[model samples]
Target: MLGSVTLLLERLGARTRHLAGSFVYAVGFGIEVARQLVLFLFGKRPAFRVLTLQILFTGVEALAIVAVLSLSLGAVIIIQGLSLLPQFGQAELTYTVLVVVITRELGPILTAFIVAARSGTAVATELGTMVVNREIEAYIATGVNPIAYLVVPRVIGVTVSVILLNVYFNVFGLAGAFFASRPTAGVALWEYVAQLGAVLQVRDLLGSALKSAVFGVIIALVSCHHGLLVEQASTEIPQQAIRAVSRCFVLLIVVNAGLTLVYYL
Candidate 1:
């Protein structure tokens, strides 16, 4: 019994140490990426072509799905709220609910989830493949700063993509709700617009934008960190990709919840 307990404690300690080391390494990687981003902004010219392609792939390619999901969610919210809130004589509160749900909460989080699932996994798998194929080594041999040329572009692209997608989400979601209400609730466009304008505060917009930006940074950093973790075999690529997605999802949720709490407090 004593030996078993000792063995368990040893394993736990090893796991704790590994996690601590990984956290420290990730922080270092993020700092390097930030430094490279500043240098690129200052005309160090990391890789404009890579950054453009990354934005194209992660942002532009993702519009259709984001539009569809946001539209559906908004329509459902409007329909349900119109049907239910009227019974309690609180129908006017629907606009507040819409802004709260779509703008301040679900908009940022759902957008983050979509980006993490789509772009995060892709970034990890692509980088892992490069590592496995020794392309990263080739870049190093050629005196190319792989972090600057390869990673920084992706970080900026993913972050910008997530923020833009959240904006798209808010637009489509509110517009869908308005149109959906026309047939069911018979709410005129002007009245709906006025009600939303009244209830939607500047803080709400700032909060949503802040959440999107933070979630974007989290997704990009976690994805890149896991991607570069791939060491040897091709088999490790998918595993690292899976790790990236899982970590991004978890971090997004935790960070979103933390931000929401702070917003309320």
Candidate 2:
């Protein structure tokens, strides 16, 4: 009985320690990424080419998927809103529903999820493979700062890409809703645009941008952190990538809820 109790205590202690270490590492990673971003703003960072390529990979390459998903989502919302809202004589609420669902909520979150599932896992896998292959050490030996050259570009790329993709998603989503509404309710384009403009507040726009930015930052930091945590063996690369993607998804959800609550309050 005593032995079993001791074993349980040991396991709990180790788990706590692991959690504490992960928290600290995440904090430090965020700080480092922020510092690098400041440098980037001043044109003091190297690897502009790398940064551009990362943006293309994370943002441009993901555009089609974001567009398709957003279009479908918006069409569905508009169709349902048009069908159901008239029964309650709240057809005008369609604009409200569109603003709330597309602009304020689903847009940023879905964009983040796409970027996380795509680039986040890729970043983790790439970095983990680099670590396993000692490429990171090779950079250090050549007197290069891996954080600035490797991590900064990726961090910036992912964040910028996610933001841009979120904007595109919103644009496509609204367009989809417009097209879908024509068939369903025969709402005129100008009237639909007016309604959307009237229903969309500056505050909602600001909130949506803020949410996208935060989600981008979270995806970058979480992916990079997990990738860097890899130690020894190529077998661990896939595991780290999986962890990065999972952690990013969970963090995005939690942060989304918190931001939504704060925005309303």
Q: Give per-candidate clash totals.
A: 0, 0
Worst 10 residues of 1 by lDDT: 37-46
Q: Give the C-alpha miss distance for residue 168 in model 1, angstroms.
A: 0.7
Question: Can you write out model 2's per-residue Cα lDDT over 10-100, one digit (the tens) per residue?
Answer: 9999999999998888788778777877887787757788889999999999999999999999999999999999889998899899989
How close to the true structure is residue 107 of candidate 2, measured as C-alpha lDDT? 96
Scored by lDDT, model 1 comes in at 0.92
lDDT of each: 0.92, 0.91
Clashes of 1: 0
Query: Candidate 2, after superposition: displacement of residue 67 in Å?
Result: 0.5
Q: State, as a TM-score between 0 and 1, how close model 2 is to the true structure.
A: 0.96
Please give the RMSD to the true structure for each candidate, in Å: 1.4, 1.2
Candidate 2 clashing pairs, residues 3+ apart or interchain: none
TM-score of 1: 0.95
Candidate 2 segments exceeding 4 Å error: none
True lDDT of residue 50, candidate 2: 85
